[model samples]
Target: MDQGFFLLFATVSVITALMLVVARNPVHSALALMACFLQISAIFVLLEAPLLAVIQIFVYVGAIMVLFLFVIMMIDMREAVLQRFLPGGNLPALVLLVVLGVEMIVLVFWSDSFSVATPATAGGGDTIRTLGTTLFADYLLPFEAASVILLVALVGAIVLARKEPG
Candidate 1:
């Protein structure tokens, strides 16, 4: 039962991710990205991380996706959508994708690191409290860095969307 749900969520996530990359319209791509994020949240639920699942849906699907759609709406994408790709432009990407897929398969099948292991028991404390403490204490730098990166991206989008006065 759990395995079936996991497979369903994982497959939808992969399909939506592919749609996000291949969709020509920026709005469609953003919608696909939102679908991918929802599928990922479902996977987090299957993994018994309800808090993470909620955060995924709230942060990625709710807040970040809204921001993405706002940016997409602000930009004029007609030229971008109508642009032609250079001949065989995707060949290099296809080759890289194939190589990475083969490498991942080899790693999954042959690497001892992927072997099943005993699951670790949760620490004897409030899970959310522990997570908050760890995030602010141990991983504070990375957390703040990610926030700064997001801030920069938001500002960049605003600047790009601004109309220039003649």
Candidate 2:
């Protein structure tokens, strides 16, 4: 992976994640979340996992984000309460951020692991074909479980969106 592009995607991902947390409007927050997901998918591509990148875009950004937007739209936004920012509320997050920064610096400057280049595709058939075979053959149960969970979540969202009986 190219260091320059990785750094750019990482920076954008972090900024958009913070924006998602801080946005006053729920819709804006969802939009920021989508931006963050896109940046993350780009980072996945940089890591030479195009399958993961496509899944990230389609699953999280396409389907899940649309569900999030629908939920946000169904809610009464006018009745939403604004939270007051306490001065000390973010201390734990700040500490974790500092630790993450130190870890990144150490990884970039001292680690030899990143010096090695990995092949873009694993074990030789077409990338998508290999992925499909592996997923359905080796990981079928887990994949089906994930799909069921997503289906349940979708049904729950629809339930929540339905009008209440008077």
Candidate 3:
């Protein structure tokens, strides 16, 4: 990848990720995350890693983002979550956040060092064929489980929307 393109992606993606976490509104945060994902996809393109880029967009942006939006829309955002009632319990949350911050800092600096030279398994071609084959063959059980979970979620959501007896 060209240094300029990498730099551009790094700057934009990092900035948008920061904005994603810092945004007060959940919708804005999701949009920022989408921008971050797209910039990362562009970086993958620059590196000739079209498979990763496609997966990033398809899984993260397409499936995961839609899930997030569905969750956001399903929840009653108007309900106030009292600070005292929140699960974090304040002090522990602060400590966890600090630890996470340190871990992210270490990862951001050293991640490039972890790249390995794995020999390509398939001929240079569109990766969808191999991905689909693996998804349908070896990982079929987990895929079916995921489908069941999604089905349950859909049913539960409908149940939650029904009026209860007084």
lDDT winner? 2
Q: Give one digit per residue, the lDDT tens place, for model 2 in 1-166.
A: 3878887998899889888976878889999999999999998988889779999999899989988998988966555454456778788887887898789778877867667556457666587888788999999999999999988988887886787789
How do the residues 87-138 of candidate 1 rate in per-residue lDDT, one tens digit apiece?
8978898788779767866776797744543333367758888878888999
User: Which residues of candidate 1, in runs, are more than 4 Å off?
Assistant: 82-89, 111-121, 136-145
Output the better candidate (1/2) by TM-score.
1
Worst 10 residues of 2 by lDDT: 76-85
Lowest lDDT 10-mer window, candidate 1? 113-122
Error of 3 at 159 (Å): 14
TM-score ranking, best first: 1, 2, 3
- Model 3 lDDT tens row, 1-166: 3666677897799789878866767788889989999999998877667888998899889987887677657655565233225555667855876797689778866887435433345665756688789889999999999989878976876665555589
Model 2 CA lDDT for position 143: 93
Task: Give candidate 2's TM-score.
Answer: 0.68
lDDT of 3 at 73: 74
TM-score versus the correct structure, for each prediction? 0.78, 0.68, 0.54
TM-score for predicted model 3 compared with the true structure: 0.54
Candidates 1 and 3 compared: the better one by lDDT is 1
lDDT-best of 1 and 2: 2
